[model samples]
Target: MTTENKGAFYTGIYRNLFKENGYSEDDITAKIENTWNRMFHGDDEMRIYSEVGGDLGYMVDTGNIDVRTEGMSYGMMMAVQLDKKEVFDRLWKWTMKYMYMTEGENAGYFAWSCGLDGSKNAYGPAPDGEEYFALALLFASNRWGDGTEEPFNYSKQAKDLLHTVIHKGEKDDGYPMWNPENKLIKFVANCEFSDPSYHLPHFYELFSLWCYPEDSAFWKEAAHASREYLKIACHPETGLAPEYAHYDGTPNHIRGFGHFFSDSYRVAANIGLDYEWFRGSEWEIENANKIQAFFSDKEPEDYRRYTIAGEPFEEKSLHPTGLLATNAMASLAADGPHAKENVELFWNTPLRSGERRYYDNCLYLFALLALSGNFKIWFPKEK
Candidate 1:
């Protein structure tokens, strides 16, 4: 709990668990790069990213056969962390050309879904996509500097988007992404519910410093609010959180989302990264520990949808490989008995294959980058 200068922001040291666990640096680097290469440019069965024209690209949600802001924004974050500026720019360009809503109630937000041909499939915004898009854009600006063009003015684009996210409803033009009263992000721009995986205090911590000066304090409060909200959303003993929850932290059962499933897998990963990046909360450590413990005896092949209290359903998990990857990523914060074992299990697991490879492999690479100390915060260049 005594963080002091222990966090990466203060000390610039990201823990390389792979090396500590005796994996050679060469092996670790090869594993990361090879996985990334395959996911981006490999054969039809392996690749998720598809380049269009010369400058635009998109990450397809393979199972759904469509483009999603979730996958696209996630791809951008992955690219920026690995210094793949060209790839980052391509994804951003596609996002703007196809997903950016220019003149509607959702203006300034990206459409959450689109056809593979770059046609809009939905005009409403998903909060998770906007948050990740903003963070990835900010990182791109810091790492590569902003371009003068429309979508390329990275920092400004990020700030402007965030401003709209927080301030949209002030003039009754549209709804804000985060509930202003509680500072918790909504499931979508027009909803009152929240997604536990969407509560990324780690990103908010950085946003508070890098966003427009006038909005700095709100982001700071948001960071704190998300940290506290997680404590309520996640079960005390099991550490499982529903995919969607009410603002008061109870499960929101609308559309059958009030259970632990694919989206809930991210809570553990998010808690791990938040602790590593900022050392923000002791409770995060406990939560990570609890999560790893709960999964310690469970195998990916047998994974299932579950109640937050840990009751399992007969329905198998759609993204079990992704679940293992995230639980392993939880080791970044968890120092419990299961931490090393979870990491070892994840290390030996191969990238998922077949029609559902997109989501699983995305989480897989994220965990790999995180555990290998490759995923990092890109601080802005000094003037």
Candidate 2:
């Protein structure tokens, strides 16, 4: 490799170290403790756990409870990765007991949100939460094996919930919204939000692994639909995707925070190799490259700092815009000559160490797992 390449390689490694270093012993311990306290003893009147920031910051409770699910799941997985078995065990128990089960119309399937006191405040289902739960449970199953039973059940429930969505086509306006009453699909939120990026591709992968051979086509279709929507949502010039878009894929009226973030990276990562799913050609490869190039050309300066015309991108921290750049590098499929360097920049940035909102942390965890190749439930052991 040339000098520039060598520098890039070290940069990438440095970013990983920065991310690893951010979590001091105290920070990790406190997060684990907080998760445990909230899961078990935080609030009893609500019957669900209370996340700290509701929808805005670290402890967001999307009506589906996905924010908390991903938070706790990532915390436990991180503990396990660090060989903190006791912490992992405790988090596992709390999630399995209180967080896993759903009540009301969504009974049997997991819910999206619960009250601070552990009561079901949002009695709806979401694909993002289901996908995260599936991956987490699959990890637990493999990590603990026959020694534990929770992972097995959690994984089963996740798969079942996904099956329900695929078969029912349980969505409105070309997106999967929530049906709080019957836990069925309804149009509660914006029609074109990118929230499904959480598990669209994983759904296909999981189905291929567990579902019968004849039933694999359905999962593929679902993944394709998600990819198509992404292609529609992506801004041709800036490569940034809006939080909500029209069912036809036009930018919705609501321009949330107005900067690229981890959700876009998640969608890009999931859409990898399956370029044919979008334009029926290799356009996805080019699309991925376009997004990568956009980020690479403007990163470290343009990152998290958006501008319209001459005005500075005033949106500050609605989405932690920089984190998505990190995730894009860490997760998006490399296509261009600068792909590795771009990935390195994203992986090496120390932005995640700062205080973050709920979704920000969840995306950080997702980015870390993507960079480490730990996101996949069935990835081969590193040699």
Candidate 3:
């Protein structure tokens, strides 16, 4: 029973289904709080986070046994949304202490991955991480004014980082994270390709307002470029996009990232959140419907890697929980009847427990937050 969407994204307000679907306010609040507590600090086998000495803390990649910029910034976003400044600061301290570089091509960028002990696993930065870092840090600064500390000047740090994201490689050792010719985010600083999931136009839209004033125009253009990039990168029928793609929106096969897989899942979720935040595009609702419809009948264990054209491969999804979480998030702009079912399916699913728990749990928590309308923008309080 697919309910065809006429134009759902036109409505500016996002739905709080937890409240509307008969859950008590107390229950909804308790679920959000309890989920956060357990995921971050619960039993060892279940928790992804760890505290270091007195200052730094990190969310480990349980499956890979490393820390990633992805998790760190994600943890910051979760903290800011939950008003957990202590956790946010601890994570930020760790990022600054270990991941941030001081010199060379990638000086301003945080290393993409590192050991749980804070040693570098890779020297290069992931643009996805920087995007989250800037957004979450800006939110932190707004939610809680900068403390008199170097790394704690959240907004300033965010602005400086954003400045580097757009300006690096102009005369530096490395190329910029974004393509100077097209404004599309690169897969890495020097790459000619982009990871479609890295295109967070919604974040870019907000960045235009909060980033370094001189770079504001760039972000606005980046947002427009990314939005347009997605339209071509994604399949017209399936809305599935490759994990990596060229600036012209063709899949990049150089590293076998041509298939639609794990990283691609975030594209739907980003679009959902983008539509919820800015209501900038009507096509968002249609894309949400297409992706949801394409996956509506698929069972979790049977989920397989597929091409953007919807051709399936033998490979099963490595992060099935994460995949489902993002699909559920698509409900933010989804108009199909399956939209409600997707949210309900997610609600019934527990946090994935075990080695790959880190990514799964992170996405699950985010989906929970977004569906309930708890995921939101933060602003400095009125004077």
Candidate 4:
């Protein structure tokens, strides 16, 4: 019921971690803006977005030399939360123009990867992208009036996308993004397992209210399913979760993603945001405590792949700065003794400065927006 009547609106009371750690408000805001400008418009080493033909742009995964649904949708989510419609539209345009598939069993789904030149690298859609795209489009429709155009019809696009996500295979070629029986999103349209980091309860809670009436119940069940699903996917003592897991919560090793690594970093950030948005459960508080405790003593540069049970592997983290940012984001809901320590660590860490800066900077900026309360849902003025 929290999502009805425009849903459970954001309170805009973000945790002032910087101020708590002796920073001025102006300083924090300036830092955030500076980071945003640098990430979007700075030199090659600093920026991630590339404007293609006049109206379209793509957020490239600089290190991967390709565009991914992950980065494109993430960029849109960031744009909407920051009230940057231009950036949001550009990314969405490029996605629809190039990555969207219009034929065969995958019609209406986005190809997960594409070359920088706008050619498809794969045909399979990644569910993470669809989830983010739906939520961001809904926010866009509410914030900026839906324009009279194809992709610009924001709410319609959102609703249609959600409809496809749930009913894709009802009488056709494609598969639904979620498992009808379990109500949990799949790692891919055809996969039986899931990525722990893809479970975003906060997003699902809102979807329950905004989605088509016939499927409203499905989204509500999805919210409950993701919350309980995370409880088991994450380790009780360390709060570590596998990058991929079975529906029953055990780590899935089919592709060697069972260890906590790059993708696993989002679990903490998701829990933090879910708690901030809904204040729905006590499990989040405990989960936050356990994860922060698990990494309280490890140096950021030393981050590595680890088993959900807390055993570290020899593999180094591809996105250490990102991992640190999400850990700091976790401080939003964690009332534990080590929470401040984690926030301070994140404050001291600068935006990543190398080839892999794309993903790292994206997560870094989100943490900044979230912790400062700038990442928010916008509403249209009542007529």
Candidate 5:
């Protein structure tokens, strides 16, 4: 079968879970097992699936393990959402065992991207991964309840780790540095892009939801500052955000590396949704719309070849035609006219069968699941 055909098959299975007929417990179980066996259980350690098996080499930033964490968290979230306690328990334990939250060089936050053998490979800190961990913890805590011990215990730990990032990981400039070591903030110029920004506002949102009043106030300040920095960094004319920006909020020289994905807009949207800051929200909507406009102007045949602002973006064939861009567009419009078309294009695309690019595929799937409101599919379902 063609790569596209395999993608279609998987997408069809994904659709069945949400259809009026609703997937049977057995059906869901089988599907989860298939994904787990094919992708999750491999030596890749929760890596994303690509045609070439799992891509373990792609690291997002210093401590951020975007591909693995997204897949693991999404899978765990789906397990909880579907009430699949067994699946949730297994994946959760595995994730916790491999993932660690400790006092490291930077405010002692969670370390991102350990190898499959549980070795720490990456050193950069990213906002998105931190936020997802907090979200997962919150979900686990809420589901297991206050008194419940097992999951809630871990949830509390996750929450604490998130706080560390917000309070210690961020530099005085408002943007988060790569790592905080020796009471010093280490900034990586590459993280100024929109992809990592998604997690920045979550610091405030999660704090509001979980932190004490004193702590929450501090987090809120950090969140606001991050937003201000983002506004300064993003391009006003093209609405384009760079892969990295300077501490002074200037875009970096690199444009296409981390800048091409839908997470760029997702970060902006998430910030808007999480905070009262109107500018972040407005920018999120505008950026999302701009991406849609860029893609819509081209035919599907030409979509694969299309570039962002005429700059060649990596994995263009895998991206624009996939769920990431589609759902990003859908989130912006919601019930807007382009919603159906975007969603359909994402769901119906044939980008799945090609050589697996773990990180990109994971992000793509994460956006798709988020768009469908099927967070449970990637997490544990309520039993």
Candidate 6:
């Protein structure tokens, strides 16, 4: 599946999957812009992003009523990709002012959660947020030249953060985000297990090229390791992966994360993006097809927690919109019978409203961007 002339990283030609499938370019552009406005500037219940005073801003986890590193980092990525530099800088400022951990084992990492008033809710960091933050900052550095100020020095901030992520435990001060031996990212800094959704080989591909020279080899190997890890983590027939799994890809069963649920939805999206960007693995195409086929006839309203083996549970999905969005995103890699149908269904589905809209809308926007050929790698300019 490694096509020298097809993948965006190789050819700089991103496929607009929507246009290929008959969605009008005007409608797609309007949808993307309207969604962005609604999510960032809409009324209280609709907007997740909030500007604090003059400079700082944050994304609220509406259901939890807290500011999470996940949302903040995601908002940054969303901003940078859309060329909304003001929004991106505000989110980064708020992250540094409130979430940055300065004097602990988790130093150099952002605290995973905080109150709307900027009080820490959790001191520990989530590797998902850290990885996203590093990539977003690097993209910012490339798209808009870095400033001379502290956090505004985007490239340096990203490189420094990545250094801590890969080298934190060298002197026993803290644990690194990734397992040194296996090269797979952990669910959290101190955890032994991995979240299948956290294994973003596309991001790692860029990290390998853009990170400090000394750490480049580690990231290159990590990209390969994550691709192989997904092959083991995802079910062969259904393509459902557990939210959390052991290093060998077995369901970890801790706190009942062994089953497919909310966090598990991102696996499909990640696979689609990795294939779209690098085309490093042919298995991605097969896996995406399997995922779409599994949900092709199922109603999002009837979405439920399921075993990776494809058995349903009594509980309904909390973020059904997110589930649909990710499945649609899989269309980027999938070329099977279900791919086009999935994308069409997603285009007709309305944005989720109310308490849990934060996560669902975030995934919704990302799907729209990818299918529209908007979510892209911002390579540094040649001197």
| Model 6 ranges off by over 4 Å | 1-5
lDDT tens digits, residue span 139-196, model 1: 9999999998887999999999888899997986789999888999999888888999
Residue 51 of candidate 5: its Cα lDDT? 24
Ranking by TM-score: 6, 1, 4, 3, 5, 2
lDDT of 4: 0.88
Candidate-wise lDDT, in order? 0.93, 0.45, 0.88, 0.88, 0.45, 0.93
lDDT of 2 by residue, 310-362 (tens): 13354443454434544363233445765566555654443232223344444
Give every collision pair in model 4. 3-7
Give a tens-digit lDDT track for model 5, residues 1-383. 44332322124223222222243556445544454454444444333422212322222221243335555565555445545555555555554555554444533433455565555566444455555656666666666544355444655666566556545535333334323221111233234333334435533545555654555665556565566665655555444454444555564446434343444444433432332222234455555555455555565544342222435443444433343443443342233344455555554443343344444444444444444444421222356
lDDT value, residue 276 of candidate 5: 22
lDDT of 4 by residue, 1-383 (tens): 33331212555455567788888899898998889888888888889988877889999898898999999999999899888899999999999999999998889999999999999999999999999999999999888879899889998898899989989989998899999999999999987889989999888878878888987999999999999999999998899999999999999987789989988999999998887777657899899999999998899879999999989899999999999999989887799998888888888889987689988888899899878767675555488
Candidate 3 clash pair list: 3-337
Off by over 4 Å in 5: 1-71, 81-85, 101-107, 123-125, 146-152, 169-203, 222-234, 247-249, 254-283, 299-310, 313-329, 332-337, 375-383
| Tens digits of per-residue lDDT for model 6, 227-285 | 99999999999999999999999998999999999999999999989888888688999
Candidates 3 and 6 compared by TM-score, better number: 6
**Over all chains combined, what TM-score does candidate 5 have?**
0.63
TM-score each candidate.
0.98, 0.61, 0.95, 0.96, 0.63, 0.98
Residue 240 CA displacement from its true place in model 6, Å: 0.5
Could you give me the TM-score of model 2 versus the true structure? 0.61
RMSD of each: 1.1, 9.3, 3.2, 2.5, 9.9, 1.1
